[model samples]
Target chain A: MTARIGVVTFPGSLDDRDTQRAIRLAGAEPVALWHKDKDLHQVDAVVLPGGFSYGDYLRAGAISRFSPVMETVIEQAKAGLPVLGICNGFQILTEAHLLPGGMLGNDHLHFICRDQKLRVENADTAWTVDYASGQEIHIPLKNMDGRYVADEYTLDKLEAEGRVVFRYLDFNPNGSLRDIAGITNEAGNVVGLMPHPEHATEPLIGTGRTDGLPFFTSILKKLVNA
Target chain B: MARVVVDVMLKPEILDPQGQAVQRALPRLGFDGISDVRQGKRFELEVEGPVDEAALARIHDLAESFLANTVIEDFTVKIEEVAEAVK
Candidate 1:
């Protein structure tokens, strides 16, 4: 059976189509979900693509965290649903408390856009099972508010629990705590990251390489096995 | 009616990049005496009708959960003014 992956589109979403395409490329059916719709349509998994949701008003992803659909997403995510939040979506996850930490303005006060390299710190998550531990992959990163911050205790807990799923490599693009690019919840089902893996999933577009194909394939494989 | 004002600021431990940029630029602009600049958000809410202690508590909760992210920020709420007792 082909897995059905849902991609949510908020008002300012820019990469929902790309994420759905990536899901299709991984042999899964892509379901278009609306920000106002609470029903997920029984999708095997969900992906929140990056964009300036709610115009990044008040704060990036701040207002969108309270969207009607997010109410269901948060509940399902807590119930061990496989959810991937990319960039702005990651901001929403944090704002909704589905994940730890909050994002702030880049340390240099500039919007950074680059092909970022990340090391797979913990490949045991529902979204990263295909990547080998400590393996490095390049993905595009673009955003203004991408610096992740958290309390010291929370940071230590994330590190101790091995929940830091991805860490920046070579150079820390933003001043994220401990160079963290992505992280997973305790159940390893919900993952949030500040990079655009969907943009790099296609060989023709991923800077001429398919480094981010593993993310989509990994989730599809998990759905198939379960 | 009552006016509620909530102020949210990044925790001291967390880095404030925007605030830091302003601080650094201030020196370049010949304002070197200032130090430790930080930026934050302020929300002013106007509640309808007379706000009692219960309403105050609820507003506090709203500020904590929505107006501020407790993970890396702190918030303070003040009921600025209460409605005059009407006859």
Candidate 2:
């Protein structure tokens, strides 16, 4: 059976379609999920794509964290369901308490858009298995509230547990603590990052490189193999 | 009806670039001597009945769980008196 990957579309989601396309490109069936729907459709994995969800009101991903779909995602994720949150999705993950820390406005207070370089620090996660540890790749990073913050203790704990999955390479785009571009939960089933891997999935598109395609393929391979 | 207020602000240790930008502009605007500036959000909620201790406590919980992200922000909840309107 083909791996069915669900992509959630919140009210203001901008990248849900692109994420679906990326999943299709990776040979997985893409299931469309609504923010208000509590059902997950039994998808093998879920990808929370980037966008200004709920128009970024009450904070980037704050209000959307209470959406009905998230209620199920949160519960299932804890039970070892594979989930990937990108950009605003990352904000939602943090707000939902599925991930530690929070995202704040960029240190320079600007909405930055750029092709950013990142190093895959952990390749064992559900969404990163296709990449080798320490591999450098470029993904499109764009956001106003992308600066990641957490208490020193939490930061130390994440580092000690090797939960920091991705790190900025050469340049720190949004001043994330320790140049952390992405991280995973202890189980490695949940991952969140500020870059838009969906945007970089096609070689003819955004960055003209397919570095981000690995994210989709990695999850698909894991699900199919499972 | 009663009015309740919740104020949310970033923790002191985190960087406040928006506040800093305003502070930087102050000196050029002839408003000097201000050492620092921090930005925050204020939310006013109108309740249907008396905001008793129990209600206040509920609002506090709301502020902690929804109104504020405790990871990066601190919040305070309080009752606000409604001002009488002048005819």
Candidate 3:
């Protein structure tokens, strides 16, 4: 059976097609979910792609977090549905409280776009099962508001519980606390990261490295065996 | 009708890069005696009808849920009457 992965497209979404293509390349059917639509169409998993949703008004992801589709996404995610939020999607997840912490302006106060190296601190999450623990891989990271911040207690809890799934390896690009690049919820079903994995899934494309293919393949494999 | 002002600011513990950039530029621009700077957002909401408890409560809810993210920022809501001079 082919796994159906839904990719949500918001008004300002720029990477939804790339994310869908990545999923298709991984042998899964891509479902296009709209921001205003609440129905998920029974997708096996969902990916919120990157972009400046709602023009990043008020705050990045602030307006989009309240979109009709996110209402269902949040509920399903809490019920253990596998959800991956990339870049702007990560911002929405934080704004919706589906994930902890909030993003702020980059420490350098400039938009950063580059290939970022990250270590897979925890490979057991629903979206990272294919990677070995402590594996380092490069993915494209881009955005203006990418610095992640949280209360001290919350940061300590995330560290103590091993919820920090991905940590910046060589250099901290955005001044995120403890060099965190991505994280997973306590259930390990929902993951959020400020990187564009879809852009790196095809070697013939921009970076010419398929380091991000495992993210889609990992989730597809999970759904198949289940 | 009443004018409600919402002020949102990052928590002191969190780093404010925009504020820091401004602080650094102040000295270069020949300004001194400024200890620090913190950037924030302010929203002015114009509510219709009486400025009663229910309306104030609703505004508070908006500030908590949408106007501000409690994770790294705090928000305060101030209710001010319309000055007669402006009217």
TM-score of each: 0.95, 0.99, 0.98
lDDT tens digits, residues A21-140, model 3?
999999999999999999999998999999999999999999999999999999999999999999999999999999999998889888999999999999999999999999999989
Error of 3 at A177 (Å): 0.5
Candidate DockQ scores, in order:
0.74, 0.92, 0.89
Model 2 spans > 4 angstroms off: none
Ten contiguous residues minimizing lDDT sum, candidate 2 chain A: A103-112
Best by lDDT: 2
Error of 3 at B78 (Å): 0.7
Worst 10 residues of 3 chain A by lDDT: A199-208
Which scores greater on TM-score, model 1 or model 2? 2
Tens-digit lDDT track of model 3 for B1-87: 789999999998988888988999998999998979999999999888987889989999999999999888899999977776753
> Over 4 Å off in model 1, which ranges?
B29-32, B81-87
Ranking by TM-score: 2, 3, 1
Q: Between which residue pairs do clashes occur in model 2?
A: none
List the pairs of residues colliding in candidate 3: none
Each prediction's RMSD over C-alphas, in Å, is 2.6, 0.8, 1.2
Interface RMSD of each: 1.1, 0.6, 0.7
Estimate the TM-score for candidate 3: 0.98
Candidate 1 residue lDDT tens string, A195-223: 98998987788666788889999999999
- Per-candidate clashes come to 1, 0, 0
TM-score of chain A of 2: 0.99
Place model 1 in a CAPRI quality band: medium
